[model samples]
Target: MHDVTSQAGFASPDLSAFCRLDELGLVAVGQRLEPDRAVLACRVVEPDQWCRRCGCEGVPRDTVTRRLAHEPFGWRPTSLEVIVRRYRCSGCGHVWRQGTSLAAEPRAKLSRRGLRWALEAIVVQHLSVARVAEGLGVAWDTANDAVLAEGRRVLIGDRARFDGVAAIGVDEHVWRHTRRGDKYVTVIIDLTAVRAGTGPARLLDMVAGRSKQAFKTWLADRDEAWRDGIEVVAMDGFTGFKTAAAEELPGAVAVMDPFYADVLVMPMSVVFALLRGLSGAVRSA
Candidate 1:
């Protein structure tokens, strides 16, 4: 036989090297790029899957292909046609499908990376939900739901975000500016980093109404450690907020924000000073 081993080095190009699916525990077996879209055929790298109940090794039974939306590649929306293998445990006779970390929770149409990309596009790039949906090749509701769920899970649900909070700012925001009704919300902001000159402030939470009860309830919900860590609370000239802070955060120093004080108090002080000076000048003249 003519040395067939020499041809091994001249084999076809490896698509996995370019696709970088290995980071998600997946391998690109094939690819098809078109003018409008691109499809990547992939398979999980895990050869051995265990039974859910028995914890025994599973044997391959068959494979089913599923199409999932992935992040766009060079302005073209990419889709992954993954071949998931069904397995049956030889010891316990249980059946299950191979799982990979490429996608979010099971049965989700969007991949984890796609969800992340959509969130960044909305929050950082300031893109609308419709535009993000269009870019991801998904419906508006699909994109909105995925982004909201992921944001809550990754950012809002993280309890560690409340840590290191030393200072806070509370104010009332007009949520609805219609003539029908005045709907206001109590907005709490973390001003620790801003006070320390380390980073910009971050929003802590928002309650439905602008009342002492609302603010007090929110403060009461926090753990003692978090409540104890609060040192300063900057707020507008709202007596309800001041009362709430006094009751809930006894050790915290409540102060009026400079903007409100300057606007409401400084102007009158300046006018009074000017009138007194003019009166004295009139008497002298």
Candidate 2:
């Protein structure tokens, strides 16, 4: 149990700005901070004007608290406790709760801002799923499921992501270190923007397997016109990837990725240096 100072009067600043409650049609009314979490009490700024069914005035009946995980504030997990007022229509007696869809999806655990932050942390910052879960103050499975679903819905599901592509790079990744399933996954990256000096490279797709058949099959599935548009294929020295590019895209120029090229050169450089030293006689001859 908290007294007045700990419950209602401790927060001296307008927390609405910190969490951007204004964007969600909410205003902070009170705050309570635990040693590890910050809890903000909020109320909806705009209640429904009338009942949707009867178009008559609604009389407030009761209130319910809706809990949502918000973006962390200064490394402390923050949550919003929204005070939602339920109403009953005068004419039809229909009941409804205040609108809060902007804050989150219906029954979603993470706020819209929180969801966006989690997605960016995973895709742009390259943070792992566990880190995202810790930042959101949610379970690991919950964070992973939500982020993957939202990522697919927002990015992978978009039809226009493949447009204007001219260059691609294929590589194998150790997707999982554990021993249960296939550990290697093939990642296809679009280097068109990099080649054209427009922007950084972007991910085009990912498929299972690390063989020539995997790369060739993925290329074959694309529209022939789209495949024809590729002007360059960059990859490591792995003949499997090189063979796939040659067979599927004969017209595209093949080039070694700079990072792999350095790896390949250092060994050759050492071998040649040792040969040159093997016989000061060899050079003199």
Candidate 3:
């Protein structure tokens, strides 16, 4: 719980912004929270958009419905009541109840605000799903699902915006629980000058595997225009990525830089030993 002093109130400075009423097609009807601030309630309405049926636009019908639950609203850590509507499409015989306009998907347990908060926890705070759930007072499954959904959204959104990328860096990371084996996630980084320094190094838009089909699909998904702009691809001598890069970006230069090994100066067998020694020293200290 947060304290409401003269300087700060229960209502967050960005509360209105988080609601994104205009974006959601709703105006903030009202807000209610006790002085102690145990809970905060908000009401939302559907906005004017095309019909889910015949694509005809709609106005607010007289009929309204009330939905109750905890909806994420940024880091305010409060609940929400998303009130929806019953819309009658003019173009077709469709009479359907409209869903929440704020969330990307209807009936999403996590609101857009909650999704942002959880993503911040994973990407910025570097907190695991279990820890985030404990802190946010949500179930572990809920937090984990939110993270996965948001991760996919980020990967898709960022990839869609990439254009005229001159260079790319590809790498792999292990992402399985309680496994020391071969499960991996392939991440494609935009090595373009504009995307330098921890920019868009998340998972690429593809299925995770070291197989030829996985890499091929990733390459095939890219626009042919991307191949023309790509000048170079730097990878850690992985034959799979190397092959894919060559086949997909025929014009691009492929550099199998051993520097990607992190300790290219040493043999692969000795690198693990070195890492263990470093970990042991840190633990002892």
lDDT, candidates in the order shown: 0.73, 0.76, 0.55
Poorest 10 consecutive residues of model 1 by lDDT? Answer: 276-285
Per-residue error at 265 for model 3, in Å?
Answer: 18
Give the per-residue lDDT of model 1 (tens digit) for 168-268.
Answer: 88877654544455366676777788778797666676577899999999999999999999999988888999999999999999988674343334323
Best by lDDT: 2
* Model 3 C-alpha lDDT per residue in residues 1-285, reported as the tens digit of each score: 756664554454655465553454445556776432224334454454568868987655765544322333343344444556666777875776666645546656666655666676656555556655654556666666665666656655575547656776666644443345546556565556524544433233434666655776887877788777888777775788888888888998887655433322222222222222222121211
List ranges where model 3 is wrong by over 4 Å: 1-37, 45-76, 84-99, 157-159, 180-182, 194-207, 211-213, 220-225, 256-285
Clashes of 3: 0
Tell me how far the alpha carbon of residue 157 in candidate 2 is from the true structure, in angstroms, after superposition: 2.3
Q: Candidate 1, clashing residue pairs?
A: none
lDDT, candidate 2, equals 0.76
Off by over 4 Å in 1: 1-20, 172-185, 237-239, 256-285
Model 1, position 285, has a per-residue lDDT of 10
Worst 10 contiguous positions by lDDT, candidate 3: 276-285
